[model samples]
Target: MPDGTVPQSVLEIRRDLAAAYRLIALEGMDDGIYTHISARLPDGPNGEKRFLLNPFGLRFDEVTAANLVTVDETGAVIDDPYGAGVNAAGFTIHSAVHMARHDAVCVLHTHTVAGVAVSSVKEGILPLNQWSAQFFDRIAFHDYEGIALNLEERERIVADLGNRFVMMLRNHGTLVLGRSVAEAFKLAINLERSCKAQVAALGMGLTPVVLSDDVAEHTARQYQSAYDAMELGNQSDPEWAALLRRLDAVAPDYLG
Candidate 1:
């Protein structure tokens, strides 16, 4: 039996993970329950590592805190109150990052049209806007090896993502990692916006102005400084809070 403290922490993680799934759906970043957003649980049976994932076959909007499944490192469904199994592809992609990147408490992946469009291109996300500038030289790219169902591919995926917070899955989609759910969701939203802006610029049949390397680096530094300032205050991010309020109004059941 688990201690009293473990269940509360698990519930909080579940609520955050479910909120991430719903927020992704709200932003149109979901791919029909295909993509996943996973968060590490604080404790598990026998102190083993575990994470929370959306139950397979549920649309992002349909995922509730109570329905998320608890899975072990090897993708086994250790505890699933809703009687849903885990998705093989989700396990394959997420486990690799969670295992390799201890700093990454949350891993959010998406398959939006713009994200996939950018991923399909050889150049990946360009430094076309402030949002894009933030990812300048910070994003990694992993070649798509068909569907991510084979466990062996996890090694290569981890290698490609080495210490980077954002990744472009070549010809596939986008993945963002962060030390917290707020950080991961923020990165994912910015990445998607960057990709959308790039696609729009390319669609205009004119070359987008890419910022100089120095300017891009400066902009990234500014963003990082702002993030550091925010963290120092120990306050919840206003943007993340706003999104949660939106969820409260439209999808309160995500906390159920």
Candidate 2:
């Protein structure tokens, strides 16, 4: 590969995915070493159905671009510089999305407190705010079926998340899919914020005002359009770059 070529693209994806893991930790959204964030490689030396995933047993803050492992669709390690394996549960959920959703280049899953709380509620992701409105009628819900250890659950999970970017795993956490790492991270951030706000409002013992259906629909469309436009751009998102800078200042080893 030349100077600004194949290896560069792979490195960029690794760095962005690693940055996402660190940012999740920085935002207090990580659940120790339980959750996972993965990015699909455009084309691997083996094939295109390869992805970069965080190695099991490493904390999010401990993840680095160089330490991330390359795995196939079946979660088999194709190239692991650290000789680390992926979490079985993580592979189940992420591989299902990466295989079922062709447009999903990145899959982010988290076990945040607020997200799990909201998922456990009957009325998941209430449209209490503009941010919450974006997920109104758009987010998918998959009933909890234990710890996602079975491969059969993948089909049902995909069916539940049909044509939607966000999915709340009942009694579990949240799952977000994106065409890029930036998009997936942004969605995860917003989804978590929405959950946090809803939880905070409910805890206050005050009945929150819900947005009208028409208003929520309009807002969701606007947000989706903006996201689509951002995806069409040639350069990486500035917000992603800024987040990378923040990581560089603190946990610079993420790109090691």
Please report the candidate that would top TM-score against the real structure: 2
Please give, for residues 1-256, the per-residue lDDT of candidate 2 as tens digits: 0012112377778888999999999999998888889888877555558889989899998989899999888888888888768885678889988888877878999999999999999999988898999988988999999988888999999999998889999999999998788889999999999999999998999878989999999999888777776676634467877898999899988888
Q: Model 2, stretches more than 4 Å misplaced? A: 1-8, 45-48, 234-236
Compared with the true structure, the alpha-carbon lDDT of candidate 1 equals 0.84
Segments of candidate 1 deviating more than 4 angstroms: 1-8, 229-235
List clashing residue pairs in candidate 2: none
Clashes by residue pair, model 1: none
By summed lDDT, which 10 consecutive residues of candidate 1 come out lowest? 1-10
Give per-residue CA lDDT, model 1, range 1-256, as digits (tens).
0111112266667777889999998888999968889998876558898988888899999999899898988778988888979895677779889988876778998888999999999999889889999999988999989988878998999998888889999999999986677778988999999999999998999867999999998999887666555444444578878888999999998888
TM-score of 2: 0.93
